[model samples]
Target: MHSAIPHLIELQRVDHLIVAVRTEIETFPKRVREADAKLSGARTAVAAARERLVNSQKDRKKFELDVQQWKDRAKKYRDQSGAVKTNEAYKALQHEIANAEAEVAKAEDAQLEVMMASEEAERRVRHAEANLKEDETAVTKERKVIETLQAEKKQQLDSLLAERERALAPIPEDLRELYTRIAKRHHGAGLAEARDGQCRGCGMRVLPHTLQELRRDPNEEIYRCESCGLILYTLEPVPVPGSASGSERAASSAVNHS
Candidate 1:
Protein backbone atom coordinates (compact mmCIF):
# COMPACT_ATOMS: atom_id res chain seq x y z
CA MET A 1 0.00 0.00 0.00
CA HIS A 2 2.80 2.39 0.78
CA SER A 3 4.30 1.65 -2.64
CA ALA A 4 0.95 2.50 -4.31
CA ILE A 5 1.13 6.17 -3.23
CA PRO A 6 3.72 6.91 -5.90
CA HIS A 7 1.59 5.10 -8.46
CA LEU A 8 -1.42 7.23 -7.56
CA ILE A 9 0.59 10.42 -7.97
CA GLU A 10 1.88 9.17 -11.31
CA LEU A 11 -1.64 8.35 -12.44
CA GLN A 12 -2.85 11.85 -11.63
CA ARG A 13 -0.01 13.39 -13.59
CA VAL A 14 -0.86 11.18 -16.57
CA ASP A 15 -4.46 12.31 -16.56
CA HIS A 16 -3.42 15.96 -16.62
CA LEU A 17 -0.97 15.40 -19.44
CA ILE A 18 -3.53 13.55 -21.56
CA VAL A 19 -6.06 16.32 -21.04
CA ALA A 20 -3.61 18.96 -22.19
CA VAL A 21 -2.64 16.99 -25.29
CA ARG A 22 -6.22 16.33 -26.32
CA THR A 23 -7.15 19.99 -25.97
CA GLU A 24 -4.36 21.19 -28.21
CA ILE A 25 -5.02 18.54 -30.85
CA GLU A 26 -8.68 19.43 -31.00
CA THR A 27 -8.26 23.20 -31.37
CA PHE A 28 -5.34 23.44 -33.79
CA PRO A 29 -7.29 22.06 -36.77
CA LYS A 30 -10.11 24.51 -36.21
CA ARG A 31 -7.70 27.40 -36.51
CA VAL A 32 -6.30 26.02 -39.75
CA ARG A 33 -9.78 25.58 -41.22
CA GLU A 34 -10.69 29.15 -40.32
CA ALA A 35 -7.72 30.43 -42.28
CA ASP A 36 -8.74 28.30 -45.25
CA ALA A 37 -12.25 29.73 -45.18
CA LYS A 38 -10.91 33.28 -45.37
CA LEU A 39 -8.86 32.44 -48.44
CA SER A 40 -11.87 30.84 -50.12
CA GLY A 41 -13.97 33.96 -49.56
CA ALA A 42 -11.32 36.17 -51.11
CA ARG A 43 -11.09 33.96 -54.18
CA THR A 44 -14.85 33.98 -54.62
CA ALA A 45 -14.89 37.78 -54.58
CA VAL A 46 -12.20 37.94 -57.27
CA ALA A 47 -14.10 35.52 -59.47
CA ALA A 48 -17.31 37.55 -59.23
CA ALA A 49 -15.50 40.76 -60.16
CA ARG A 50 -13.83 39.09 -63.14
CA GLU A 51 -17.19 37.82 -64.40
CA ARG A 52 -18.65 41.32 -64.25
CA LEU A 53 -15.72 42.71 -66.23
CA VAL A 54 -16.21 40.10 -68.94
CA ASN A 55 -19.94 40.85 -69.24
CA SER A 56 -19.26 44.59 -69.47
CA GLN A 57 -16.70 44.10 -72.23
CA LYS A 58 -19.19 41.98 -74.17
CA ASP A 59 -21.86 44.69 -73.89
CA ARG A 60 -19.37 47.31 -75.11
CA LYS A 61 -18.49 45.26 -78.19
CA LYS A 62 -22.20 44.76 -79.08
CA PHE A 63 -22.84 48.50 -78.80
CA GLU A 64 -19.86 49.26 -81.04
CA LEU A 65 -21.15 46.85 -83.70
CA ASP A 66 -24.62 48.42 -83.63
CA VAL A 67 -23.05 51.88 -84.11
CA GLN A 68 -21.02 50.64 -87.09
CA GLN A 69 -24.17 49.15 -88.74
CA TRP A 70 -26.02 52.47 -88.39
CA LYS A 71 -23.09 54.41 -89.90
CA ASP A 72 -23.06 52.02 -92.90
CA ARG A 73 -26.81 52.55 -93.47
CA ALA A 74 -26.35 56.37 -93.35
CA LYS A 75 -23.50 56.21 -95.92
CA LYS A 76 -25.69 54.14 -98.27
CA TYR A 77 -28.53 56.69 -98.05
CA ARG A 78 -26.08 59.57 -98.81
CA ASP A 79 -24.70 57.76 -101.87
CA GLN A 80 -28.27 57.22 -103.24
CA SER A 81 -29.41 60.82 -102.71
CA GLY A 82 -28.41 61.84 -106.35
CA ALA A 83 -30.73 59.16 -107.83
CA VAL A 84 -33.85 60.85 -106.46
CA LYS A 85 -35.55 62.96 -109.19
CA THR A 86 -38.17 64.83 -107.17
CA ASN A 87 -37.02 67.60 -104.79
CA GLU A 88 -39.37 66.29 -102.08
CA ALA A 89 -37.90 62.80 -102.40
CA TYR A 90 -34.35 64.16 -102.21
CA LYS A 91 -35.16 66.18 -99.07
CA ALA A 92 -36.83 63.16 -97.47
CA LEU A 93 -33.77 61.01 -98.19
CA GLN A 94 -31.52 63.69 -96.68
CA HIS A 95 -33.72 63.76 -93.54
CA GLU A 96 -33.44 59.96 -93.24
CA ILE A 97 -29.63 60.19 -93.53
CA ALA A 98 -29.52 62.89 -90.82
CA ASN A 99 -31.63 60.77 -88.44
CA ALA A 100 -29.43 57.71 -89.09
CA GLU A 101 -26.32 59.79 -88.42
CA ALA A 102 -27.83 61.00 -85.13
CA GLU A 103 -28.60 57.42 -84.13
CA VAL A 104 -25.05 56.36 -84.98
CA ALA A 105 -23.63 59.21 -82.88
CA LYS A 106 -25.79 58.20 -79.90
CA ALA A 107 -24.75 54.55 -80.28
CA GLU A 108 -21.07 55.57 -80.42
CA ASP A 109 -21.48 57.58 -77.23
CA ALA A 110 -23.15 54.62 -75.49
CA GLN A 111 -20.37 52.32 -76.66
CA LEU A 112 -17.73 54.69 -75.32
CA GLU A 113 -19.46 54.79 -71.96
CA VAL A 114 -19.60 51.02 -71.87
CA MET A 115 -15.90 50.78 -72.78
CA MET A 116 -14.97 53.16 -69.97
CA ALA A 117 -17.06 51.21 -67.51
CA SER A 118 -15.46 47.97 -68.67
CA GLU A 119 -12.02 49.44 -68.13
CA GLU A 120 -12.95 50.39 -64.59
CA ALA A 121 -14.41 46.97 -64.00
CA GLU A 122 -11.26 45.37 -65.37
CA ARG A 123 -9.17 47.42 -62.92
CA ARG A 124 -11.39 46.32 -60.09
CA VAL A 125 -11.03 42.70 -61.15
CA ARG A 126 -7.26 43.05 -61.17
CA HIS A 127 -7.28 44.52 -57.69
CA ALA A 128 -9.53 41.78 -56.40
CA GLU A 129 -7.32 39.16 -57.99
CA ALA A 130 -4.28 40.64 -56.28
CA ASN A 131 -6.06 40.59 -52.93
CA LEU A 132 -7.11 37.01 -53.45
CA LYS A 133 -3.60 35.98 -54.32
CA GLU A 134 -2.23 37.66 -51.25
CA ASP A 135 -4.81 35.99 -49.04
CA GLU A 136 -4.08 32.59 -50.55
CA THR A 137 -0.38 33.07 -49.94
CA ALA A 138 -1.04 34.01 -46.37
CA VAL A 139 -3.27 31.00 -45.89
CA THR A 140 -0.63 28.73 -47.32
CA LYS A 141 1.97 30.03 -44.93
CA GLU A 142 -0.34 29.81 -41.96
CA ARG A 143 -1.34 26.26 -42.84
CA LYS A 144 2.27 25.25 -42.97
CA VAL A 145 2.85 26.78 -39.58
CA ILE A 146 -0.17 24.98 -38.19
CA GLU A 147 1.02 21.71 -39.64
CA THR A 148 4.43 22.10 -38.06
CA LEU A 149 2.95 22.92 -34.71
CA GLN A 150 0.54 20.03 -34.89
CA ALA A 151 3.33 17.66 -35.72
CA GLU A 152 5.37 18.84 -32.77
CA LYS A 153 2.38 18.61 -30.47
CA LYS A 154 1.55 15.16 -31.73
CA GLN A 155 5.06 13.98 -31.09
CA GLN A 156 5.05 15.30 -27.56
CA LEU A 157 1.58 13.98 -26.88
CA ASP A 158 2.49 10.53 -28.14
CA SER A 159 5.49 10.40 -25.83
CA LEU A 160 3.42 11.60 -22.91
CA LEU A 161 0.67 9.11 -23.60
CA ALA A 162 3.18 6.30 -23.67
CA GLU A 163 4.58 7.40 -20.36
CA ARG A 164 1.12 7.76 -18.87
CA GLU A 165 0.08 4.31 -19.95
CA ARG A 166 3.17 2.89 -18.31
CA ALA A 167 2.55 4.84 -15.16
CA LEU A 168 -1.07 3.71 -14.92
CA ALA A 169 -0.20 0.06 -15.54
CA PRO A 170 0.55 -0.72 -11.89
CA ILE A 171 -2.57 0.93 -10.48
CA PRO A 172 -5.31 -1.50 -9.42
CA GLU A 173 -8.13 -1.59 -11.96
CA ASP A 174 -10.85 -0.39 -9.55
CA LEU A 175 -8.74 2.44 -8.24
CA ARG A 176 -7.77 3.42 -11.76
CA GLU A 177 -11.42 3.61 -12.75
CA LEU A 178 -12.18 5.69 -9.68
CA TYR A 179 -9.40 8.11 -10.52
CA THR A 180 -10.56 8.49 -14.13
CA ARG A 181 -14.13 9.14 -13.02
CA ILE A 182 -13.06 11.75 -10.50
CA ALA A 183 -10.79 13.41 -13.08
CA LYS A 184 -13.62 13.63 -15.57
CA ARG A 185 -15.90 15.13 -12.96
CA HIS A 186 -13.32 17.57 -11.58
CA HIS A 187 -11.64 18.94 -14.69
CA GLY A 188 -8.44 16.87 -14.70
CA ALA A 189 -7.57 17.11 -11.04
CA GLY A 190 -8.65 13.81 -9.48
CA LEU A 191 -6.12 14.04 -6.64
CA ALA A 192 -6.05 16.92 -4.17
CA GLU A 193 -3.72 17.32 -1.22
CA ALA A 194 -5.10 17.82 2.29
CA ARG A 195 -3.24 20.92 3.51
CA ASP A 196 -3.43 22.08 7.12
CA GLY A 197 -6.57 19.99 7.69
CA GLN A 198 -8.26 21.54 4.65
CA CYS A 199 -9.03 20.02 1.24
CA ARG A 200 -6.68 21.72 -1.23
CA GLY A 201 -9.16 21.33 -4.07
CA CYS A 202 -12.13 23.06 -2.38
CA GLY A 203 -10.58 24.54 0.79
CA MET A 204 -13.11 22.64 2.88
CA ARG A 205 -12.09 21.91 6.47
CA VAL A 206 -11.42 18.24 7.15
CA LEU A 207 -13.10 16.51 10.06
CA PRO A 208 -10.66 15.78 12.89
CA HIS A 209 -11.51 12.08 12.70
CA THR A 210 -10.94 12.01 8.95
CA LEU A 211 -7.60 13.80 9.33
CA GLN A 212 -6.54 11.26 11.97
CA GLU A 213 -7.59 8.43 9.68
CA LEU A 214 -5.70 10.04 6.77
CA ARG A 215 -2.53 10.41 8.84
CA ARG A 216 -2.36 6.68 9.58
CA ASP A 217 -1.27 5.18 6.25
CA PRO A 218 -1.09 6.87 2.81
CA ASN A 219 -1.93 3.82 0.70
CA GLU A 220 -4.45 1.78 2.74
CA GLU A 221 -7.62 3.00 1.02
CA ILE A 222 -8.49 5.69 -1.46
CA TYR A 223 -9.38 8.84 0.46
CA ARG A 224 -11.55 11.38 -1.37
CA CYS A 225 -12.58 14.90 -0.55
CA GLU A 226 -16.03 14.93 1.07
CA SER A 227 -16.92 18.20 -0.61
CA CYS A 228 -15.30 17.81 -4.00
CA GLY A 229 -14.82 14.03 -4.43
CA LEU A 230 -11.11 14.43 -5.21
CA ILE A 231 -8.59 11.91 -3.89
CA LEU A 232 -7.10 13.55 -0.79
CA TYR A 233 -3.42 13.60 0.16
CA THR A 234 -2.31 15.14 3.40
CA LEU A 235 0.26 17.91 3.10
CA GLU A 236 2.38 17.84 6.26
CA PRO A 237 5.07 20.46 6.70
CA VAL A 238 7.63 17.83 7.75
CA PRO A 239 9.45 15.94 4.99
CA VAL A 240 9.45 12.15 5.16
CA PRO A 241 11.62 9.59 3.38
CA GLY A 242 10.30 8.67 -0.05
CA SER A 243 7.78 11.55 0.33
CA ALA A 244 8.10 15.12 -0.91
CA SER A 245 5.81 16.64 1.76
CA GLY A 246 3.58 15.67 4.65
CA SER A 247 0.79 15.21 2.13
CA GLU A 248 2.52 11.99 1.09
CA ARG A 249 2.04 10.76 4.64
CA ALA A 250 -1.69 11.39 4.36
CA ALA A 251 -1.69 9.78 0.92
CA SER A 252 0.28 6.83 2.28
CA SER A 253 -2.13 6.46 5.18
CA ALA A 254 -5.07 6.27 2.77
CA VAL A 255 -3.24 3.67 0.69
CA ASN A 256 -2.65 1.63 3.83
CA HIS A 257 -6.37 1.67 4.55
CA SER A 258 -7.09 0.60 0.99
Candidate 2:
Protein backbone atom coordinates (compact mmCIF):
# COMPACT_ATOMS: atom_id res chain seq x y z
CA MET A 1 0.00 0.00 0.00
CA HIS A 2 1.18 3.51 -0.72
CA SER A 3 2.05 5.61 2.35
CA ALA A 4 -0.52 8.24 1.31
CA ILE A 5 -3.35 5.70 1.16
CA PRO A 6 -3.75 5.52 4.94
CA HIS A 7 -4.16 9.29 5.20
CA LEU A 8 -6.64 9.23 2.33
CA ILE A 9 -8.62 6.49 4.06
CA GLU A 10 -8.71 8.51 7.27
CA LEU A 11 -9.89 11.58 5.39
CA GLN A 12 -12.57 9.56 3.64
CA ARG A 13 -13.79 8.21 6.98
CA VAL A 14 -14.18 11.72 8.39
CA ASP A 15 -15.97 12.89 5.26
CA HIS A 16 -18.41 10.01 5.38
CA LEU A 17 -19.24 10.74 9.00
CA ILE A 18 -19.70 14.44 8.26
CA VAL A 19 -22.14 13.66 5.49
CA ALA A 20 -24.13 11.25 7.67
CA VAL A 21 -24.44 13.75 10.50
CA ARG A 22 -25.48 16.51 8.12
CA THR A 23 -28.16 14.30 6.59
CA GLU A 24 -29.54 13.53 10.05
CA ILE A 25 -29.51 17.18 11.08
CA GLU A 26 -31.37 18.14 7.93
CA THR A 27 -34.41 16.06 8.97
CA PHE A 28 -34.95 18.01 12.19
CA PRO A 29 -36.92 20.83 10.54
CA LYS A 30 -39.32 18.45 8.83
CA ARG A 31 -39.82 16.60 12.07
CA VAL A 32 -40.64 19.82 13.95
CA ARG A 33 -43.07 20.84 11.23
CA GLU A 34 -44.85 17.50 11.36
CA ALA A 35 -45.26 17.79 15.11
CA ASP A 36 -46.46 21.38 14.80
CA ALA A 37 -49.01 20.35 12.18
CA LYS A 38 -50.78 18.14 14.66
CA LEU A 39 -50.83 20.93 17.19
CA SER A 40 -52.20 23.35 14.60
CA GLY A 41 -54.96 20.93 13.69
CA ALA A 42 -55.95 20.61 17.31
CA ARG A 43 -56.08 24.37 17.72
CA THR A 44 -58.29 24.70 14.64
CA ALA A 45 -60.73 22.16 16.02
CA VAL A 46 -61.00 24.11 19.24
CA ALA A 47 -61.65 27.34 17.33
CA ALA A 48 -64.38 25.77 15.23
CA ALA A 49 -66.06 24.23 18.25
CA ARG A 50 -66.03 27.57 20.10
CA GLU A 51 -67.53 29.27 17.10
CA ARG A 52 -70.40 26.80 17.13
CA LEU A 53 -70.90 27.34 20.83
CA VAL A 54 -71.08 31.11 20.34
CA ASN A 55 -73.68 30.72 17.55
CA SER A 56 -75.86 28.53 19.74
CA GLN A 57 -75.69 31.05 22.59
CA LYS A 58 -76.75 33.83 20.21
CA ASP A 59 -79.71 31.77 19.01
CA ARG A 60 -80.82 31.10 22.59
CA LYS A 61 -80.68 34.81 23.44
CA LYS A 62 -82.81 35.72 20.41
CA PHE A 63 -85.46 33.13 21.40
CA GLU A 64 -85.47 34.40 24.99
CA LEU A 65 -86.08 37.99 23.82
CA ASP A 66 -88.89 36.81 21.51
CA VAL A 67 -90.59 35.02 24.42
CA GLN A 68 -90.36 38.19 26.56
CA GLN A 69 -91.92 40.34 23.82
CA TRP A 70 -94.86 37.94 23.41
CA LYS A 71 -95.43 37.87 27.19
CA ASP A 72 -95.54 41.69 27.27
CA ARG A 73 -98.06 41.73 24.41
CA ALA A 74 -100.25 39.21 26.21
CA LYS A 75 -100.20 41.41 29.35
CA LYS A 76 -101.26 44.47 27.29
CA TYR A 77 -104.17 42.54 25.77
CA ARG A 78 -105.36 41.39 29.24
CA ASP A 79 -105.29 44.97 30.58
CA GLN A 80 -107.68 46.05 27.82
CA SER A 81 -109.98 43.03 28.57
CA GLY A 82 -112.00 44.63 31.46
CA ALA A 83 -112.41 48.00 29.61
CA VAL A 84 -114.21 46.42 26.64
CA LYS A 85 -118.07 46.60 27.02
CA THR A 86 -119.32 44.69 23.95
CA ASN A 87 -119.43 40.88 24.05
CA GLU A 88 -117.79 40.49 20.62
CA ALA A 89 -115.00 42.99 21.48
CA TYR A 90 -114.29 41.20 24.79
CA LYS A 91 -114.13 37.87 22.93
CA ALA A 92 -111.77 39.38 20.34
CA LEU A 93 -109.59 40.83 23.12
CA GLN A 94 -109.46 37.41 24.81
CA HIS A 95 -108.61 35.83 21.46
CA GLU A 96 -105.64 38.25 21.01
CA ILE A 97 -104.34 37.36 24.50
CA ALA A 98 -104.69 33.66 23.71
CA ASN A 99 -102.75 34.15 20.45
CA ALA A 100 -100.03 36.05 22.26
CA GLU A 101 -99.83 33.33 24.94
CA ALA A 102 -99.54 30.66 22.18
CA GLU A 103 -96.71 32.64 20.64
CA VAL A 104 -94.99 32.75 24.05
CA ALA A 105 -95.35 28.98 24.35
CA LYS A 106 -93.85 28.49 20.90
CA ALA A 107 -90.97 30.84 21.65
CA GLU A 108 -90.32 28.99 24.97
CA ASP A 109 -90.18 25.68 23.09
CA ALA A 110 -87.71 27.13 20.58
CA GLN A 111 -85.64 28.55 23.46
CA LEU A 112 -85.55 25.10 25.07
CA GLU A 113 -84.27 23.61 21.79
CA VAL A 114 -81.66 26.35 21.52
CA MET A 115 -80.52 25.65 25.11
CA MET A 116 -80.15 21.96 24.28
CA ALA A 117 -78.12 22.79 21.20
CA SER A 118 -76.01 25.15 23.27
CA GLU A 119 -75.30 22.36 25.74
CA GLU A 120 -74.19 20.08 22.93
CA ALA A 121 -71.99 22.84 21.56
CA GLU A 122 -70.43 23.33 24.98
CA ARG A 123 -69.68 19.62 25.15
CA ARG A 124 -68.01 19.73 21.77
CA VAL A 125 -65.94 22.76 22.76
CA ARG A 126 -64.79 21.03 25.91
CA HIS A 127 -63.82 17.94 23.96
CA ALA A 128 -61.93 19.97 21.39
CA GLU A 129 -60.11 21.93 24.11
CA ALA A 130 -59.06 18.70 25.80
CA ASN A 131 -57.68 17.37 22.55
CA LEU A 132 -55.81 20.60 21.95
CA LYS A 133 -54.17 20.48 25.37
CA GLU A 134 -53.18 16.85 24.90
CA ASP A 135 -51.73 17.56 21.49
CA GLU A 136 -49.80 20.57 22.79
CA THR A 137 -48.15 18.51 25.49
CA ALA A 138 -47.15 15.77 23.10
CA VAL A 139 -45.89 18.19 20.50
CA THR A 140 -43.86 20.12 23.03
CA LYS A 141 -42.20 16.94 24.27
CA GLU A 142 -41.50 15.73 20.76
CA ARG A 143 -39.99 19.05 19.70
CA LYS A 144 -37.70 19.03 22.72
CA VAL A 145 -36.48 15.55 21.89
CA ILE A 146 -35.91 16.53 18.29
CA GLU A 147 -34.04 19.65 19.33
CA THR A 148 -31.80 17.65 21.63
CA LEU A 149 -30.98 15.14 18.90
CA GLN A 150 -30.30 17.93 16.44
CA ALA A 151 -27.87 19.55 18.86
CA GLU A 152 -26.01 16.27 19.31
CA LYS A 153 -25.76 15.74 15.56
CA LYS A 154 -24.55 19.31 15.11
CA GLN A 155 -21.78 18.69 17.62
CA GLN A 156 -20.78 15.49 15.85
CA LEU A 157 -20.69 17.23 12.48
CA ASP A 158 -18.59 20.05 13.88
CA SER A 159 -16.06 17.62 15.39
CA LEU A 160 -15.88 15.58 12.20
CA LEU A 161 -15.34 18.67 10.05
CA ALA A 162 -12.44 19.75 12.24
CA GLU A 163 -10.98 16.24 12.13
CA ARG A 164 -11.28 16.24 8.35
CA GLU A 165 -8.98 19.25 8.18
CA ARG A 166 -6.41 17.48 10.35
CA ALA A 167 -6.55 14.37 8.18
CA LEU A 168 -6.19 16.48 5.05
CA ALA A 169 -3.24 18.49 6.37
CA PRO A 170 -0.61 15.75 5.92
CA ILE A 171 -1.70 14.81 2.39
CA PRO A 172 0.07 16.58 -0.46
CA GLU A 173 -1.89 19.25 -2.38
CA ASP A 174 -1.81 17.33 -5.69
CA LEU A 175 -2.95 14.11 -4.06
CA ARG A 176 -5.72 16.00 -2.26
CA GLU A 177 -6.94 17.42 -5.55
CA LEU A 178 -6.88 13.98 -7.14
CA TYR A 179 -8.87 12.52 -4.27
CA THR A 180 -11.41 15.37 -4.39
CA ARG A 181 -11.92 14.90 -8.12
CA ILE A 182 -12.41 11.16 -7.84
CA ALA A 183 -14.68 11.43 -4.84
CA LYS A 184 -16.85 13.97 -6.63
CA ARG A 185 -17.17 11.61 -9.59
CA HIS A 186 -18.05 8.69 -7.35
CA HIS A 187 -20.43 10.40 -4.96
CA GLY A 188 -17.94 11.11 -2.17
CA ALA A 189 -16.35 7.64 -2.23
CA GLY A 190 -12.88 7.92 -3.71
CA LEU A 191 -11.17 4.92 -2.11
CA ALA A 192 -12.07 1.26 -2.63
CA GLU A 193 -10.68 -1.84 -0.90
CA ALA A 194 -9.02 -4.36 -3.18
CA ARG A 195 -9.83 -7.86 -1.85
CA ASP A 196 -10.69 -11.35 -3.15
CA GLY A 197 -8.96 -10.47 -6.46
CA GLN A 198 -11.64 -7.76 -7.07
CA CYS A 199 -12.24 -4.04 -6.74
CA ARG A 200 -14.94 -3.63 -4.08
CA GLY A 201 -16.17 -0.34 -5.57
CA CYS A 202 -16.82 -1.50 -9.14
CA GLY A 203 -16.39 -5.31 -8.85
CA MET A 204 -13.67 -5.27 -11.48
CA ARG A 205 -11.01 -7.96 -11.32
CA VAL A 206 -7.58 -6.94 -10.03
CA LEU A 207 -4.49 -8.24 -11.81
CA PRO A 208 -2.48 -10.91 -9.96
CA HIS A 209 0.77 -8.90 -10.21
CA THR A 210 -0.89 -5.76 -8.91
CA LEU A 211 -2.43 -7.80 -6.11
CA GLN A 212 0.96 -9.29 -5.27
CA GLU A 213 2.54 -5.83 -5.29
CA LEU A 214 -0.15 -4.47 -2.96
CA ARG A 215 0.42 -7.42 -0.67
CA ARG A 216 4.12 -6.54 -0.50
CA ASP A 217 4.81 -4.57 2.74
CA PRO A 218 7.24 -1.99 1.40
CA ASN A 219 5.21 -1.23 -1.72
CA GLU A 220 4.79 2.49 -2.49
CA GLU A 221 2.70 2.20 -5.63
CA ILE A 222 -0.67 4.01 -5.66
CA TYR A 223 -3.06 1.75 -7.57
CA ARG A 224 -6.31 2.74 -9.29
CA CYS A 225 -9.06 0.50 -10.66
CA GLU A 226 -9.00 0.45 -14.47
CA SER A 227 -12.76 0.22 -14.84
CA CYS A 228 -13.87 2.82 -12.27
CA GLY A 229 -10.69 4.85 -11.72
CA LEU A 230 -10.97 4.63 -7.93
CA ILE A 231 -7.84 4.34 -5.82
CA LEU A 232 -7.51 0.87 -4.24
CA TYR A 233 -5.87 -0.40 -1.05
CA THR A 234 -5.37 -3.90 0.30
CA LEU A 235 -5.13 -5.42 3.74
CA GLU A 236 -1.69 -7.01 4.15
CA PRO A 237 -1.62 -10.26 6.04
CA VAL A 238 0.39 -10.30 9.31
CA PRO A 239 3.62 -12.23 8.84
CA VAL A 240 4.29 -15.06 11.34
CA PRO A 241 7.72 -14.97 12.96
CA GLY A 242 9.80 -18.14 12.71
CA SER A 243 11.70 -17.53 15.98
CA ALA A 244 10.36 -17.61 19.56
CA SER A 245 10.41 -14.65 21.91
CA GLY A 246 12.36 -14.57 25.22
CA SER A 247 9.25 -15.40 27.28
CA GLU A 248 8.49 -18.45 25.15
CA ARG A 249 12.15 -19.60 25.27
CA ALA A 250 12.15 -19.34 29.08
CA ALA A 251 9.01 -21.52 29.28
CA SER A 252 10.57 -24.03 26.88
CA SER A 253 13.73 -24.18 29.03
CA ALA A 254 11.57 -24.78 32.10
CA VAL A 255 9.79 -27.64 30.34
CA ASN A 256 13.09 -29.19 29.27
CA HIS A 257 14.43 -29.07 32.85
CA SER A 258 11.26 -30.69 34.19
The candidate that wins on TM-score is 2
Clashing pairs in 2: none
Among all windows of 10 consecutive residues in model 2, the one with the lowest summed lDDT is 236-245
Per-residue lDDT tens digits for candidate 1, residues 1-258, read 235557778878876877888899899979999989998888888989999999998999899898999999999999999799999999999999999999999999999999999999999999999999899889999999999999998998899888988888888888788888888888888788887889999999888777666666544776778899888866454335666666677888999999
Best by lDDT: 2
Residue 21 C-alpha lDDT in model 2: 88
Query: For residue 140, what is the lDDT in candidate 1?
Result: 93
Candidate 1 Cα RMSD (Å) = 7.6
Q: Please give the CA lDDT of all the candidate structures.
A: 0.84, 0.91
